[model samples]
Target chain A: MFELILTLVLLVIGFVFGQIAEKRHFRSIIQREAETRDLLCFNERRIPQDMFSPHVTLVCGSVVVSVDFFKHFVATLRNLVGGRVSAYESLLERARREAVLRMKAQALAQGATSVWNVRVETSSIHQGQRQGIGAVEVMAYGTALVPR
Target chain B: MIVTNIEYIPGKKITQHLGMVSGNTVRAKHVGRDLMAGLKNIVGGELKGYTELLTESREEAVRRMVAQAEAIGANAVLNVRFSTSSVAAGAAELFAYGTAVVAE
Candidate 1:
């Protein structure tokens, strides 16, 4: 009985704090994305022919995020039904956006006007023995074109 | 060395193609970080330790790739790409590859 009560209390705490953190992260991502709008980023395998850049370098950004216990619990329940797990979707979205933002920031810092062949890779880390997911990592990388 | 994910570098000419070069590294999180990440999961936030680990692993892979390119006397690496996979329960491998070239 005590264990059950403790689990419920943790779930409530996770729900409340997790929601707040997710909201804050989303706001920050939106704001930064707007700020870096002018930096051209693409997945094309070729640099624009018209581009007059003489120097190119690699740039990357990475982020690791984990779902709260409440969402993890909910996702496990959803898994029983064997359908889409929406609870983890938002977690992935946040991590991807954040990683891209950081990569853009790096390019901008290096005086790069554009990034090409951008790619994002994701992986799951720190899975508990019994729990489903402990954390997810998103890595964004690209070549930055800086004009001479 | 000049490194770009694109097949061709604008305004530069490739004098020779040195073939493919690659670097890879596998890393695992420490127990302390694993514990910390577990707690962070309860609250739902960024896991700084894992982020740092991935970053370090990427840098190491890139460095090794560049070393290989230099060994072939290549001045640039083109069409660079990276990949990651879980090799173990608590470890991941980061791999980077590109075509080394001599350019001017």
Candidate 2:
């Protein structure tokens, strides 16, 4: 019985570490931010922005999470459905955010100011349900536009 | 990431760009989620760096893009493109560009 308990504890610890490392990896990829020159400007229009802003996006191919989202989710879900949701949410959100950020980074590299009509789309790699070690993806994309 | 209402509308003069457009700090939760996705790339996982930044930057970009397009009296945007660059170590940029045209 003691051995079993110990093994369980080790498994949790390992998972936690993996989570931490994964977090670091995401941070590094999206380490860059918006620059003044990289800002897309369209000064002529009148329509305002809505949906989610000052927002961040990441797309893979499935689900995605942002730092704020994952943290809040982990805390809230932990209080509700325990931490089992951690692995699923963690992977999904992470991929989503990374994919979105990469799109932005690519835009910036192209000497564009901003990307418009931003969105993240998700698609499953394998058909059928995403159960038991199945890998899925969520893609984040938007128009890289220049301000008028 | 495909955005809605960004194309030229028959009655509307130009496409409406909607997304996150702000000059504020990105939260930790969002960043945390992004990191997890980055790690997945190791095993031929999808890289999602573009999605996050695009989503965040699109709002601002669209806001400006629309404003400019409107100013130019453009009714539509076509063949858009995205671009980015390094501002600071932890900061980057995302931009969208397209031909602002006056489509009936």
* Best-matching candidate per lDDT: 1
- Tens-digit lDDT track of model 1 for A1-148: 9999989998998999999999999999999999999999998867766886888889999998988999989998998888888889999999999999999999999999999889998877744446534788898999898987
- Candidate 1, residue A4: the lDDT equals 100
Model 2 lDDT at residue A39: 51
Worst 10 residues of 2 chain A by lDDT: A54-63
Q: Which stretches in model 1 have alpha-carbon errors above 4 Å?
A: A126-133
Per-candidate TM equals 0.94, 0.39
Docking class of 2: incorrect
Candidate 1 chain B: 10-residue stretch with minimal lDDT: B83-92
lDDT of 1 by residue, B1-104 (tens): 99888788788899899899999999998888777777887889998887888899999999999999999899999988888877776687999999999999
The prediction achieving the highest DockQ against the true structure is 1
**What TM value does chain A in model 2 reach?**
0.51
lDDT over C-alpha atoms for residue B93 of model 2: 52
